[model samples]
Target: MANIKIVLADTDDKYLMPLERKFIDGLEDKADLIVITDPDYLKEYFSEPQRVDILIINEELYDAELERHNIASVFILTEQELLNNNTGDAEANRIYKYTSVKEIYAEIIGKSSARSETLNTKEETKILMMYSPIGGIGKTTVSAALCEALAKYQKKVLLIGIDSLQTIGSVIPQLPFMESGTEKLLIEKSEYVYEAVKTKIINRTFDLLPPFHLSLPSLNIKGEDYINLINGIRDSKDYDYVIVDGATGFTEDLSRLMGVADHTIILAGQDKNAVYKLDCLLRNIDCSDNDRFVFVCNKYRNNRENFLANGYMTNFCRVSEYIELWTENSASEEGVLTNNRSIQKLALMFI
Candidate 1:
């Protein structure tokens, strides 16, 4: 019921004038709207904490200071809905530069109200880890699909790829190849891990920290560092869910990741070696006291008989779900899960 103070910072008159007119016409009595067309003045205005209810600025002008400001909600204005991996804020919501003024008003008001509600009643963020003991089984595909499906439901999602090879770039080509992301967070003490990850998001589907560009068999990230990163992301409160795509095998890094994960999706295929390695992984890793462990059989070919006869499912304590994406052509199709209702249904279990 209180008056909301909103700030619109951008230099383009062609884009700014229309939005300014609409804000005054629609919210004259309800809010105070301040429009700044200069980047320097905007930066100076946000140098200190301001009592802003909502702050909308162009993506090019965004910085950590804007985030440091005590604003109820922040939205980045961009040419496209999907932000580039380098310049966008993963934590903050975004609006298209060419959208209708009514749509802009609705977005600002809706998100500001939601922010107030969230602040008043804090909710837990769900953390899901997609892991496999062996590689080359469509693990990255399933992880990307799950994130996309979750986003389709309007849930804020963050996806972190900890694999040494950095397969997420291939899975989601829209994402930029960052030379250092999670590793930068680890090595540098000045940057915040949550803020760093927020800037590397792609398509609003998920916030991602692309894997380090390392050809080594193992990553330089320590167990404590990995745990700290996860804890930082969980505590950020920017996302509704955090999805991690972990490396294969039972390494210390994988163990630490699973240890903090709320739900662990153990991916396997119909291959005998894959099943055997998965059984070995189950025995070696300590997941007995975790929150939840789900076994997902990817590329399933109606091999229920083979799965049961080979006693593959019996090796694990429980099999939470199975996915049937067995076609040779299905793997090549982009946005397969986003367009497929059946696949989206299977992905909803993570939520």
Candidate 2:
């Protein structure tokens, strides 16, 4: 049985059907969702002595008397544009009716539980690290898009960016100005980075840890720190998927950290320099578990001749030309992922 029970009261049978399916698909067994379309049934359902963790009700059907039921939380969904409607019942929530289901579900989860409290309650979190042997090839774009995609599909996803170059702030503009999660975690050398980082998490499509505020070299975050931090999240087991977004370029330290991931996505192009750098990195790293890596050829031109480089090939995870990050001038790219769909195939690799 799911640990939480959620009741949704709405008279639209068609509207509730898809929301029920979406809840089933995204939450799986984490939340038991009940949809009541009949107003009488909705009243009777709540009248019974039942434990409902959350109640999302249509404003028309909601009665002030229902507050006596002591429901854990009650959210009123309004179809009209109402201003300052949170006037009564201070604990009640007023939500616009047309928001995406994923956004609503994300908000519910953010309010229902704390990351630290979920430790040991979830299954193992699969860690996927995104890296680029060459810069300006949509690593951040792919990672951010994939994070949202997974959250839409499963509703439990965590995104951690270690972008010392500060590109993630531009890529994920919702990110609250830097919180130094890296410095705080390393200073205490704590095993609670997952919990500590999520305290500042916004209720977006997915929860993102405020990325490393300082340069990695300044803090000297080593391979062990990476292992401990990632393993801590895995052991905590709060998320279904954990996506770690890497910064520009590649290095031995970066490669060593990539080794910690359950699956590693290395982005490159069809150029000789990309092949040379990846080849060198492969030679340096312990490729004993070779199947863990996914080499992606970004900005792919569909040229078969360019695909064959130094006897190696990369999976083409290309973004359209409209995305300004295709070249080395990623600084000009903003909101490239607003309508991007190329990341679905990449998201399927983990799902």
Candidate 3:
């Protein structure tokens, strides 16, 4: 068995001290252990990358920084019975309070062993581009929903909005203004692009790189710049999925973005004009077997003609995987598509 490097972090003095002692005693000469009780020290420790084999942290202390480092095995310690009741998956490891040291040891060793076996098989980050030629097709809504759903499943996701109009701000209000400006960061050559992206991340769920805050008539971003930006994000290894919400319409920049993506999700509607536009867009782009493409019919209504329209879409699009997102009135009112069960289920399939 490989020796593990473990970090036990918790805030409760009464609970943390005894648990630390027990862990040290149980794993003595078998592993390297570090105990952290102070919040400031814990934050400082995670500021940079640390080779932590296993992280046993309080549920309340879990943050985006932990997720960013790509810790392979994480076990959240909680006192709530409800939280501890659902801990089966590799990502959802949890330990209830007052558990015996032997039980804790078994859980840690089991998860750590599994982590070691697959350490060399880490999957490359997936870049998914969400685009539509037709406007008002709810592309942004679907993009945001996909990010949120992936995050909920413990997958780190980054949302990049390439639309010059900056519609993401309308959905997610009070977005922090980029002091350096998104345009400046992308256009200028810099070695710290990855670090710069880390600082702009919001709520630990996903990072948003919107268009220039200043209202310029048009952005000067070119196709190559967009490619470089996406490449930098992929190389950073900070996110499991990078979702680019491109502007509506088929442009050189959009085509290039799709070329770099591992998967492209094309959004369309049931209307004849939308279908015609989609067919035209498909003809322009060269989507081969290597690049996966999924067709989604947004705002779908249950009717005989609309159902046949979905069948017609497959004939021209040449994509086997097709999904329909029915119009949900509450999706707008809630301001979050994942709140709707159907949307959530659909989003989960993307990952």
lDDT of 3 at 21: 76
Q: Which ten residues in a row have the lowest lDDT in candidate 3?
A: 114-123
Clashes of each: 1, 0, 0
TM-score of model 2 vs. true structure: 0.57
Off by over 4 Å in 1: 1-122, 179-182, 189-191, 216-219, 286-291, 303-305, 312-315, 326-336, 339-342
lDDT of 3 by residue, 1-351 (tens): 566687888887787777777667756766677888888999999988887778898988877568777576788888765423466544657777666554565456544654565222345789998988888888887888778766665566888877767777666666765555666665664666666655666663556664457642354656567678778878877677888887887777777788899888888777778777877886887654534776777766656255325665566655333345545655544354645545545454454
The global Cα lDDT (0 to 1) of model 1 is: 0.68
105-155, model 2: which lDDT tens digit per residue? Answer: 555555555422431255678989988767777787778777876764544
* Candidate 1 worst ten-residue window by lDDT: 114-123
Give candidate 3's whole-model lDDT.
Answer: 0.69
RMSD of 2: 8.5
Q: lDDT per residue, candidate 1, 84-170, as tens digits? A: 223445557777777556556655654565555422333588888888887788788888888776765556787877776776767
